[model samples]
Target: MDQAVLPLSPTEQETSLGSIVPPHTADAYWLTPYGAPGAWSTNTTYIVGHSWEGRASPFNNISSLSQPGDVLTVTTAEGPVHYKIDRVTTEYKDTLKDSAIWDKAPGRLVLITCFMEDLGGKNIIIQASPLPAA
Candidate 1:
């Protein structure tokens, strides 16, 4: 469950690349131009990674064990941000760009990873919102 979050490469950031094939690493990559945690109060923050089949990986548990109401913590330089899972679902790869994942929601956290069981055709998407301040 512990993995580093890497920033996109300069080329990736400049191009705003959104690839289904994740970087060749076990860590997650922050989606560029989307703003980092707490950088914007109303922009969705996307973190993408890979789900390896037949092997343990950082994102593997997201699809296999995550559930609604679960707490997802994102560590940032400023501090940690906590999100309460709202849903977990899968979408066919070809149509994901047009799906509801791109909706503009304030302080939304979205995690994207390949669906290990259907790597060639599907993606697992987890959506959550910032935990209300205590």
Candidate 2:
């Protein structure tokens, strides 16, 4: 919960080539060019990181976010934004871009990481929506 969210921007070359890879770091990365967290925009904000085996990383815990009502918060410069887990599903690495997680939605969040158990085959995707203020 105390993790940092670093901005990740694809290089112009990578962007032009249509290839983008998240950096190899333990911190969560906010995919730039999309709506930032807590924004009232028309794009889904994506936070991605690696899930390593035998290592205690925050992203490794993403696989446990299976319950629909679970909540997680992302702290931005403005403040904290809360999201409620809508669904958690996995997609093949080859077909991930075409998955439902890429849908354009206002105030939606999608956390992505490699599925450790099936590291080479699929990716773990945790989709959530902004939680209303109490």
Candidate 3:
């Protein structure tokens, strides 16, 4: 896949991270180590995107997809990964949803982006879980 949409390798960023590590990307998808890709345990995996209202990026509309039970697909080197939207909410930058963001079961995904309405203060979060084997 082209990194123009995501990074091929982790690009270094001057950031302060408490867990695993932040994914590298100038304008691509970030796969944080909050949870292992295939690990379906109580550890939450976090993927984040930049919320550019008019920018052409996958996460640009992260805030606008406000329907529950929707599906989000991620194509990786291994194969396609699928998850179903379980929750979506706006959380103040100060008051984050602990249970929703961390210590999650395996096969779960957490997507975060800057809140367009909050002027970069709050975050729009999306939570999804793996689909049942078909």
Which scores higher on TM-score, 1 or 2?
A: 2
Where is the poorest 10-residue window by lDDT in model 1? 9-18
Residue-wise lDDT of candidate 2 within 12-121, one digit each (tens)? Answer: 88545533568866778888977788847578998888877887777886777466789888877677888998888888887775676766898999888889888677
lDDT of 3: 0.59
Off by over 4 Å in 2: 12-19
The CA lDDT of each predicted structure is 0.79, 0.79, 0.59
How many angstroms is residue 32 displaced in model 3 relative to the true structure, after the best TM-score fit? 3.9
Please provide, for model 1 over 93-128, each residue's C-alpha lDDT reduced to its tens digit, 9 standing for 90 to 100. Answer: 878877777877768999998888898899999998
Output the lDDT of residue 101, model 3: 71
TM-score: which candidate is best?
2
Instruction: For candidate 2, list the clashing residue pairs, or say none.
Output: none
The model with the greater TM-score, 1 or 3, is 1
Stretches of candidate 1 off by over 4 Å are 9-20
User: TM-scores for all candidates?
Assistant: 0.86, 0.87, 0.69
- Local distance difference test, candidate 2: 0.79
